[model samples]
Target: MSPRTGVRLVTIFSAVVLAFFLFGDWLARRDAPEPLAWYETYRESLWQPIQDRSLTLLQADQALGRGHLWMISADGEPALVSRYNLESDDRLWQAQAVIGLGAEEMESLVEAQAWEPGIRDQPVSPAVGEALGDRQILRMSMIPVEPLELNRIEGTFGSPDVRMPVSEGEAWVYPRAGAVVAVGEEEAFSIMFGLRDES
Candidate 1:
């Protein structure tokens, strides 16, 4: 074969191999399931709990599925909280729910040996589970695996009701919706849902 012909054949073979790999990559990506978006998860899993005054652990489980429950003191108040690692497109986002317990429920949980300091894997006693089942969820928070685009926050929730300057960024509060979004220069870093005192 002529040198020029051999060179042309080699170039054609390389181009074909490159195109085959590119097409395979595209196919694999297209077939893979896309991870849930933060906004969608908020609307679906968190919105109802925040809106209803009577949401409970049982109801939350029905909405968000069973998660890892822990005994905690939130804002100096004894509370039970559950955390779930939510799968997202980029990474696992964290969802937390804080459940407020009454005096009686707290006593029951204490007696049931539910509170283990610094340990989250302790098996929940029947009494502890019963006590937590009916308690109200005071707040819910979603921490994205990656920072959220600033425009996405504004687009979903509209402008903030209050904006406070912080060391890293600004905190945008939407009291009516019971939401707080901590925004950095380019993106939002955190989102919380619960009632906040205006003052």
Candidate 2:
């Protein structure tokens, strides 16, 4: 009402607004996430061990070249990601070919062929079969065989109790882990190492 009272109230309001802005700015700067090195990123932490091992094997055999590495977000956390071009990368194909199968055992895959049973039967190589059997799911970066090939793999495992879409692909889920393959014209590949639950 009074000029003096109005002036006092305006002064108080200005100071409060100034303080609020200053505090907010300070808090934002303090809580900002720090930039991480390639190895320290979340994707790296999750996938680096496999990448390093693969690289080492390639290096030891004198076939190592520039390997691919990139960053991705996993469950809202920063993560490092890498994938091998299965159809193109000879070294990777060789390494993955030998992951759990011997040379003869690897050749056994030729005998395994996708067949259609009452439900449907997909044939998988012994190496793929063994990896599928042991790990129950491939790692995130492993190349996906063709869908027909994958379907046969799933058929070998029996139909998934529950199948659902994750992102742009479908996931054939099992009890312990889930198999997700991205199917699209642009990206028609499967991650042999399916996405696992962090829980």
Candidate 3:
């Protein structure tokens, strides 16, 4: 190629490269992650004064102290509350002061135990879904119970069925998992996520 043509080609390439990087930096700076950015939005928007009052007044599961339920977290990292606050409907979330269950809840859990059933090819109905969860497989230490008989386990309902002794422990609420089925001698909570207090 001629010297003139090569110089023209090189000049065009350099201009294009320069334009690309310049735009890229502008985009990144505009979208930078800012911690207080979210907080500032909440104050300026619908949540306004309420959010401001909350930041100063509300802390830790209701009472003010070290165990505050809502805070920036230990390592300056975002925590559950911090993340939740970013949502537009954050005001709707009822601020819960309750952490672990009370004495009564503990007492109910005392007689009852969680069972870990083996994973099956499909999820049996909590009643018949034998391969459900730990709450279902292990009979409560206090009560004598038998696991349901079944095989295949299924979808996202990964948590197994749980059983509590007939009429005991504030009714086994498998809050996080799946729906609960009323079996012969057991109260079934679906999966193990919703009301799953167990890890």
lDDT of each candidate versus the true structure? 0.72, 0.39, 0.29
TM-score of each: 0.63, 0.30, 0.21
Task: Give the candidates in order of lDDT, highest first.
Answer: 1, 2, 3
Candidate with the larger TM-score of 1 and 2 = 1
Order the candidates by TM-score, highest first: 1, 2, 3
Candidate 1 vs candidate 2: which has greater lDDT? Answer: 1
**Which prediction has the highest TM-score against the true structure?**
1
- With candidate 3 superimposed using the best TM-score fit, by how many Å does residue 92's alpha carbon deviate from the native? 5.3
lDDT of candidate 1 over 1-199, digit per residue (tens) = 9999999999999999999999999998785544336666656456655655666777777776777776665544455678778776566678788877778767776667555455443444445555568777888887888887766677667778889998888999987677888888878887888765455
Give the C-alpha miss distance for residue 156 in model 1, angstroms. 1.7
Q: In candidate 3, residue 107 scores what lDDT?
A: 45
Per-residue lDDT over 1-199 for candidate 3, one digit per residue giving the tens place of the 0 to 100 score? 9999999999999999999999999998675533222223432321222222222222221222222222222243221121111122121222212122335533443334221233222211222111111111111011113232111111212334454554532233333332233334333221111132335
Q: Which ten residues in a row have the lowest lDDT in candidate 3?
A: 135-144
